[model samples]
Target: VDFPLRGEWIYLRSFGHHPHAYDFVKIGNNRKYYSNGNLLSYIFGRVPANIFYCWSAPVYSPVAGVVIKANDGWPDNKVVNLASTIILWVKATFLFRPAKDGPDLDIRPNAGNYIMIQSESGFIAFMAHMRSGSIKVKTGQQVAEGQAVGEVGNSGNTTMPHLHFNLFDQINDPYQAKVIPFVFRSFERRNGNNWESVQNNTPKIKGEAIRKQL
Candidate 1:
């Protein structure tokens, strides 16, 4: 619970858009948590083509742990509209495996490209849907926070390119992960230049926006 916030480059959007809207999942309306379960690389904003190919950037380590699972060969799927959710799910189920870290899965077997950090707090951090062959760390290798592990990408059962990040108490039973609420040691809010701190934060929803000090 006392670790540094790992993500900075990526902004967020659509917080708490899913059913489990909460401080850990959504700040207002933006979906803060990863579709599969990894911390994001960027926040949601009008970055132009950034949404499509932006995830190719590297993902940093939230904590130090060995690489438990990773797969990056999969490609990003197109974003889905509200009406086609059922059809998407059906197709995904037939073609992909369920998300290993949550009940509502957005990842598949091998979890695309990912890294698992076994925090000193006895928590395992899972970052998934990484770019193909972008992983920098290896299994059993020790990594430091903010260490480059892989690039964000759309893979597995994900709809687009985005880092799926999460902290798990156990890697074996990912579905039982207890969403740990946290904040950054230093970040700006509302575009302020000063480095500020945040806690128990969620992402901004559609139509709502906020800026953080980077």
Candidate 2:
């Protein structure tokens, strides 16, 4: 598979060998700094969705496939501060209990707005945390590889803006499906102030900036 977005981005939660908390091997991409390498462009205050560089950036299809599911209409949540973020995490972990077998497909909003495309190889490519109403394709629509499908957003149970990409075997019951490992064909990695080119590498560390080699 190819990198889904353009420009420099940081990989947050990526696993190469096994699935993470949700039983699906997912990759979370985010762009925190601006072009000038400034981590924070403005003084710390209420961080809106626009402050994040990856917010609303075009998301492309990683593979040629048919859109099996295209869900939207979820409002993007506000960006919370560090303290509030910790509290929210604590509450979600201790106070509120989630379903052990995963959320029901009919009522679960865990992924917020998302798109799932079944590739020609029979693997379903899932993209989540998309901007509300930004999906460009519909269910049953065929999409070519690298085609624009949506934009990254700060939706769902996220503290900031990011794109969550994953692959699953079962389309109807995604949480119960087996995760498939995949790698980018070509990409760039962060090396201090410079971006280094890498091929067939799985980005798994936080603060690691990378971009699609185009």
Candidate 3:
């Protein structure tokens, strides 16, 4: 029942390069800063600034929680192309460098421009991969449900543009957190019909595309 986002809604490119219905990990979800390797390599690279600045083209708040964390001003890194599997391991071993606080290791964590809002249900909705400098609110600010928080863009450890929305039980521990299931109140779920009213839940196939009834 995971509701993609909370508020009035802004259209964003699905980071999961698959079709409309294929459920998957979005682009920025897995990657390192600058080196273009997967999350493992990104962890090794650890450059915080590999993500660059962008802006929210539209605003939408998934919840009304106060800001627990907001990091901005990191620049994105250039995309890269890795060679064969064997080469990846060899190169990663030699090229992998621990992230440092020095000038070269300035890339911030991959949660590029993002907002963590508290939901009335006692959970937090995390919206990541935001355009840099497009965050409209600040820490401790009370955002309304479905309000505009920021626009979608490729900032953090992303290869393209899209919105990364997820629900977490705890903010401090994201990787260890469990994903919460949710539903949209009045959106139409495509059930072979043009506009089927989906009340509480909907199941998404691997490659199906479903859109909310506007």
Candidate 4:
């Protein structure tokens, strides 16, 4: 699958991280400035949800496939304070653990609004933390690669607005599904003062900006 969003986006909770290393990978696409930017466009003491540049940014399908699941009902949560955000990161990094129960495991609420598409190659592509009521596709709908499916939001267990993407082997249950590693066709990496091109490499660090090559 190709990079799901366009323009320069920082990689966070990316590969090799706790939650991402185990299953999901996250990308932060919006910035106050294109190159060197602040956390929010305009900081008014506390960063509000709408102040985030990524909030409601269009999200696309990474692969041509049939939608296996689509959810879009929950409202986006308010952006938390810096301390709360830090605490969340600590909890996710050290205290988070996947449920061991097989059939009884529940992950829907935690995932919030999302879309799951089964690629022609058979792997399930999952995108979570989408904006409420922004999903444009439905279950069983056919979608092409790069098709706009929804918008980014601060839903689910997130501290800010960003895209949470993952690939899985199973579609029936998220808890039962095993994560599958995938690579982008091509992407741009942020260099010291410029963006560098990278081919077929997975992003690994926070604040690494990447632009998808169409």
Candidate 5:
């Protein structure tokens, strides 16, 4: 499958070999001076979401499929704060769940704006925390592989702006789906100022930054 994003990006984290729930962010050339390429400024006080390198970057579909779910109504949390993140987590769990059927609207605080596509192979590709009003497709609409879907944003339960992407074999049952292992077609791994070619691999190397092959 294709990487859900284009251009240079940072492979922030991974969820092992099971389903490859890769959290990705784009930092462009910011990696030269600051190790944390995503942040344009030192993270101390209230940091606006726009300063992050990955903020508003476009996200793509890894495979061709029909859009099962799509919503873009939630607004991004303008700033990132550790204290507020914890508080929101608690409220989203203890307070929000009881308030309404959040999963139905795809507005659950855990995922600000999201898209779920059922691939031809029956795997469900889920991309979450997209920028508000940035989604381009609607439910039941067919899309092509590598199609532009939305932009990453600082929404939902995120501490900063980034794309939360994963795939699973849920078929008609998206909620119960478990992330399954997958690999990207190609990407270039950064080694200092230079980059090396990597092909057909899971993005598991920690502290490694990568970009799609141009």
Candidate 6:
């Protein structure tokens, strides 16, 4: 399978921390947010969704598969204020709902748009935090690898636009589904101002910028 995101210089961060260590969530940005140059914006300002470089970037299918589930039409979380965004995130943590998409989805403030594709091998590919109304595929539809599925967005509990991707053994059940790990066939990692080629491996640290290939 190929990486879901298209383009170069994309920022990739693996939650080498706890709980999320297996999930691959890519976060892209137009520029550095926390640094000597943008400390105020990083700490106090409300950052608009468009300011994120990955906000509307196309998300491609890493493998040819039939879509098993597709959730859409949730509005992008606008930047009303930093406080409001945090409040929403906090609210979602406590209101857990069934993993499937349904009307009760709103009860979980962080439950955003998502899609699940079942590969021929029966492996389920899951992607979340997709842009509202940007999903191009529907359930029971077969798709080819590299096909555009949707665009990344700041949905769910995310404070900024990003893509939450993973592979599972089952669909419509996160509690029972087992996460499967995968490595990129080829890609480049950012090292200072240069890009270093990575083969048959995955990034494990935060703030690691990577691309499909050099």
- RMSD after CA superposition, every candidate: 8.5, 5.4, 10.0, 4.7, 3.7, 3.9
Which pairs clash inside model 5?
A: 19-179, 19-180
Better of 2 and 6 by TM-score: 6
Q: CA shift at 77, candidate 6, in angstroms? A: 0.3
Q: Quick one: best TM-score, which candidate? A: 5
Cα lDDT, all candidates = 0.49, 0.69, 0.49, 0.71, 0.75, 0.68
Residues 121-182, model 1: lDDT tens digits: 67677777677777787777777766777876655544445556656567566466665644
After superposing candidate 2 on the true structure, give the runs of residues whose Cα lies further than 4 Å from its correct spot: 14-45, 87-104
Leading candidate by lDDT? 5
**TM values, all candidates:** 0.58, 0.77, 0.57, 0.78, 0.83, 0.79
Say which prediction, candidate 3 or candidate 5, comes out ahead on lDDT. 5
What is candidate 4's lDDT per residue for 1-214, written digit by digit as tens? 7778876576666323434331222343434342122445323345666656677878889899999889788677765456656665665555666454455443444566889899999999888878888999999999999999998887766666778888888867655778878788788887877788888777776656677654
Q: How many backbone clashes does candidate 3 have?
A: 31
Kindly give the number of clashing pairs for every candidate: 31, 0, 31, 0, 2, 0
Off by over 4 Å in 5: 14-19, 28-44, 88-107
Consecutive 10-residue window with the lowest summed lDDT within model 6:
14-23
Candidate 1, position 59, lDDT? 61
Which ranges in model 1 have alpha carbons more than 4 Å from their true place? 1-53, 76-111, 191-214
* Deviation from native of the Cα of residue 46 in model 4, angstroms: 3.8
Q: Report the Cα lDDT for residue 155, model 3.
A: 63
Query: What digit string (tens of lDDT, one per residue) describes model 2 on residues 1-214?
Result: 8788887676665333244311111233333343222334223445666566666889899899899889888888765455555654455444543354334463224566889899999988888878888999999999999999999886666556778787887767645788777888788887877788888867767556677744
